[model samples]
Target: MMIIKEPKELQQELKRRRFEAAKQGRELTVGLVPTMGYLHEGHASLIRKARANDVVVLSIFVNPIQFGPNEDLDRYPRDAARDLALAEKECVDIVFMPEVQHMYPQPTKTKIQVEGLTSSLCGASRPGHFDGVTTVVAKLFHITKPDFAYFGMKDAQQVAVLSQMVADLNMDVQLVPCPIVRESDGMALSSRNVYLNEEQRSQALVLSASLKEAYELVQEQKSTTAAELKKLLTERIEAKPLAEIDYVEVLTFPELEPISEQTRLSDYEGDIIAALAVKFGSTRLIDNMLFQKKDVALHV
Candidate 1:
């Protein structure tokens, strides 16, 4: 796999590939998987999906802009050699690992914000977090210019914000949302999982378990009220001694508007996402599940 550090070099390579494919009388499909460096099975799942394209580029830049002042920026995580090995194993064609300076040689003034979508959930807690995410992702899309970009459903809000940005701005890339990859015990795999101690790790199961309970409530019991669902989730996490609730929200998909108490589950068509962020010690983790009324009714 080729390791590209400079933006210009990466752009030049992509242009060359495009030209070569055009010369062969065929169109090239490039898939991009943007990440913040600590490679895991979740990232590998994205890589595997990207492998379907003729050219796959995996970016491993730990974006400083996306992190807040009090957030784990300096100590997020990094293992370049390990990440490169994983990229190679996943058959990735190019790994773009750019330095902060390389990405922002001289940042003056430019921020991409997805407005309403960023106003709630993790956005409410983190503040300017989604703005940083959208800005860097927009930069990456412009530099990589891939035909398709892949993201995990584990970050349901991130996916929602970026998807809106793509549509609103008329970006050329197709955003591909992949399923969440979780551990056997149901904790959604995250790079930050390394920060969890043995005890904290065990307690962390509450995040997923709470979502599972919410799913059962809606799918099995046909419980349609958002208030009851959020209440159940909040209580489930608060019961875990190590877990501290950050946010428990049930909202409509894509739109991401709050599910009103008046809105019945059976009456709402399309997808609904139950997302939450909780802290097990100082390590903050997030997870979400997507539900469709038809699928829920069928199980009932």
Candidate 2:
């Protein structure tokens, strides 16, 4: 219910709330849901999960550091009023929406880099992007001091990288990865979805469509190789003239290492993530499905 702007103020307020709860002989647990200013069902799902904790703190800062030089930092969609209303609807206890200057009083010299995870997927295409991501999220973890932090699995690579950072640094927070919330038609939810025109929006479904088909093929034991899976995804998305392929990667989940081209789905012993990033008329949309190998077959 409270919207905090200053970092110190948020820390003080959380401390005060913890103190009050302690006096009542109740231990306080804080949950943090970090996001940019646009609120969608995907973000709402994260807040709902955070609500399990005693206090749900949502930070809606569109981190400038995360955006590359040519990326859409300037054009990133934002609706503070709508976001705040949604937060209120979700019963969020605190909304930490800080300005760019407040977050970075001066240019930051410190950067947290998790090496291998940063070399592929979105990181492969956008250099220094994950550095920005890790740096900003680290700042948020320090500022909010939450016992648990919630992130959507749509950005699975991010979950992997941040998890590494947390473990490596001994940070005292549990990273909760939630499922990808999608439209009825299967298009993954994203704030950038606003940039899609009618035509592009319709064609964008190919991303999810391809992923769904890929998931089925893996599940049904179609006897396909990793290379074949990538090709199938590529061909399907390429069928949509408007869809431009950024990367269609079939990599090991969390590890994100490349599976050999000849490696069949059945032979793979761990979790696999088939991720796609495609651009449709200046708007880039990403969708992926995790294939977990339980026994002879893979389950999504």
Candidate 3:
């Protein structure tokens, strides 16, 4: 496995590989698994999915642009030795680890924004966050030239936003969203989970618990309105003293259109996501469960 830091060199190397593969009368399908390091089972799941492609290119850059001023940019987490070892273990052909200077080089003059979709959920709380995500992912798409890019559904909003960006811009790469990898106890895996203290770590299970409750509620047809479900999720999370609510919302999937507080779940013909973001002490975590509406019944 090759660990490439320079952008031009990586791009040229990919070009050469493509030419060589074509000359040998072989079709090469590159799969990209983009990540901000501190590898975990969640990231490993994405890498495993990418293994289906002819070539897997894992890009490990802690993107500076996506972070807000108050965010954990400096102390996000980094262990290059471990990340490289995991990349090799995953059988990734190329690992792109670019520095901020290599990715930015100079001040970024342009930004990519998907309107309407960015108006709610995590986007509402973290302003300009998706813009940075789209910009960087676009650059990776250009550099890797992957036929498919794997992303975990743990970041459902990110999956939706990036999918829109790909379609709107007519990008050739196909996005493959894998399932959310959870701990046996049910907390969604995140690099930031490392920051959680003992008590905070236990309290973090409320996130997955709330989502599971929401899922059961929807499946049983006990909760009908968006407001009813959101209230249940809020109350469940608030029960844990350490849990602080960020946003609890039930919105249409992909479009991310908000469901009216009094609107019946059956009134929505398509799928909807029950998503919440909460802070456990200084660490903030997000979780969601998607439900598909069928007649008066909703299935998870």
Candidate 4:
């Protein structure tokens, strides 16, 4: 596996590989898995999906642009040696570990922002967050030029926003959303999980529990009202002494538009995602579940 630190060098090498494959009458399918430096099972799952392609490039850059001023940018996480070992285990073709200077040699004058989709959820809480996300992703897509970009469903909002950006910009890349990797006890795998102490870690289960409760309520009780679902989720998280609710939102999937309190579950005809962000001590975590009423008519 090649460990490339320079953006230009990696771009040139990928271009050469594509040209060579074309000359040999071989169709090359390249896949890219973009991630921050802390590699975990969730990231590994993305790599596994990318393995189906002819070449897989995993980027391990902790993008500063995507982080807010007060966010964990400085102390996010990093272990190049460990990440490389994990990528090697997955048989990744390339590991792009570009420096911040290499990724943005000068002050970035331009930014990519997806409107409407960024108006709520993580976007509402973290201003300019999606702009940073879309900008860096756009740069990565241009540099790697992969046939498909793999992203985990854990960051559902990020996936949705990027999908819109790709479609609007007519970028020649397909975004593949993988399922969320979780622990046996139902905690969603996150790089920040390392920061959680034993107590805080246990408390983090509330996020998953709330999601499960929401799923069950929709499935068993036929609970479909957004307000009632949010109230139930809030109550579940609030019951846990250590868990603090950041936001519990029930919105339409992909569109991400808020559902009115008057909207009934039976009236809604498509997938609805119940997403929540909670804080345990200083560490914040997010989890979500997507479900729809069985009796609701499918909308094509």
Q: Kindly list the per-residue Cα lDDT of model 1 for residues 1-300, writing each as its tens digit.
A: 999999999999999999999999989989999999889999999999998899999999988887889999999889999999999999999999999999999983899988899999989999989999999999999899999999988888999999999999999999999888888888899999999999999998988888887878776666558888888888988888998888888899878998787666766787888888999889999998788755642110
Q: Write model 3 residue lDDT over 68-142, tens digit each, in one string.
A: 999989999999999999989989899999999999999899899999899899999999999999999999999
Name the regions of candidate 3 deviating beyond 4 angstroms: 293-300
Compose the digit string of candidate 4's lDDT tens values, residues 1-300: 999988889899999999999999998899999999789999999999999999999999898988889998988878989999999999999999999999999989999989999989899888999999999999999899999999988899999999999999999999998888888899899999998999999888988887887776766665467788888889988988988777889889889988897676657878788899998988889988876555432111
The lDDT per prediction is 0.89, 0.91, 0.89, 0.88
**TM per candidate:** 0.96, 0.97, 0.95, 0.95
lDDT score, candidate 1, position 145: 97
Could you tell me which 10 consecutive residues in candidate 1 have the lowest summed lDDT? 291-300
RMSD values for the candidates in order, in angstroms, are 2.0, 1.8, 2.2, 2.9
Q: Per-residue error at 207 for model 4, in Å?
A: 0.6
Output the number of the lDDT-best candidate: 2
